[model samples]
Target: MDVPVLETERLIMRSFRAEDFGPMSAFFADERSFYYGGPLSAGDAWRRLAAYAGHWVLNGYGEWALEEKESGAFVGFCGPWKPGDMPEPEIAWALLPEHYGKGFAFEAARRALRHVYETLNWPTVMSLIEPGNAASIRLAERLGATAERKMEIYGREAVVYRHLPPDLLKEQFA
Candidate 1:
């Protein structure tokens, strides 16, 4: 399935592209990528980038590459990802450090949750955050998620934050 594009007032969420490789590689290689299980080698980054594209092909729904609308910069990724038996479909986001302070993550995430809750009409969605990632935990809270529990995902212990349902999201954001 072709990836669909989503837009907010300041950002455009679209499919990953080959040109995204360099930035993606840099992102994965950076020490800041630690919370995300990154700091990957170039080859690992390539395979990971390939997986992002393949995810769309296999699932018909997955992460969207976030672009700044004004400059068309590749900021990061945000969308729904459910890698088989994941307990639940997860609304995820990862932005380069340069884009961190801006509201891009929140704006993009609001749209992503909308896609999952309203478009896909899923009842509940989650954000799996590493316990040590203070930034992401705060972001998840701002996105109206609450830490439901701690569980092992892919052999690593992480906190699972439950996002509000569509109706509640509407009321919260309205």
Candidate 2:
């Protein structure tokens, strides 16, 4: 599947490339990656990155590499990501710890959610956030998602934040 490029005022969401592996390796090894299921070794990082790349082929849409347009750096990934083990399609993202607190996650996610609802026309999308992850919980809330319930994913309990359909969001986004 051909991944479409998405542009925001401050970011360019695009496909993963070969060079992304190095930074991903570093990202996975960092302690900040805990909430993102990291602290993984280089090999595990490869599998994770490879999974993102392959998801496009299998599902037609998957996670995207978030690039800072001004600095041209790979900040993280944000978009449709469903590994088939989850309860539903998820709109998820993760940024390097240094890039946190700047609203980039929300900015990139708004665009992704718009595409999911407006373009793909999916009924609903969920963000599976770790319960202790206050930052992500806040981001989900800012995106108009409400806490639905608790569930297990990857052996850990997570908060399933449910996002309303795009029509309710259209006015605010417009």
Candidate whose lDDT is highest: 2
lDDT of 1: 0.90
Query: lDDT tens digits, residues 6-95, model 2?
Result: 999999999999899988999999998999898999999999999999999999999899999999998999999888887789999999
Error of 2 at 88 (Å): 0.9
Reference-based TM-score, model 1: 0.97
Positional deviation of residue 80's Cα in model 2 after best superposition, in angstroms: 0.7
Q: Candidate 2 regions off by >4 Å?
A: none
What's the lDDT for all of these models?
Answer: 0.90, 0.92
Q: Write the per-residue lDDT of candidate 1 for residues 22-96, one digit (tens) a residue.
A: 999999999999877799999999898888888889887899999999999999998988777688778888999
Model 1, C-alpha of 38: deviation from truth (Å)? 0.6
Error of 1 at 24 (Å): 0.2
What TM-score, over all chains together, does every model reach? 0.97, 0.97
RMSD of each: 1.0, 0.9
Evaluate candidate 2 by giving its C-alpha RMSD to the native, one decimal: 0.9
lDDT of 2 at 107: 94
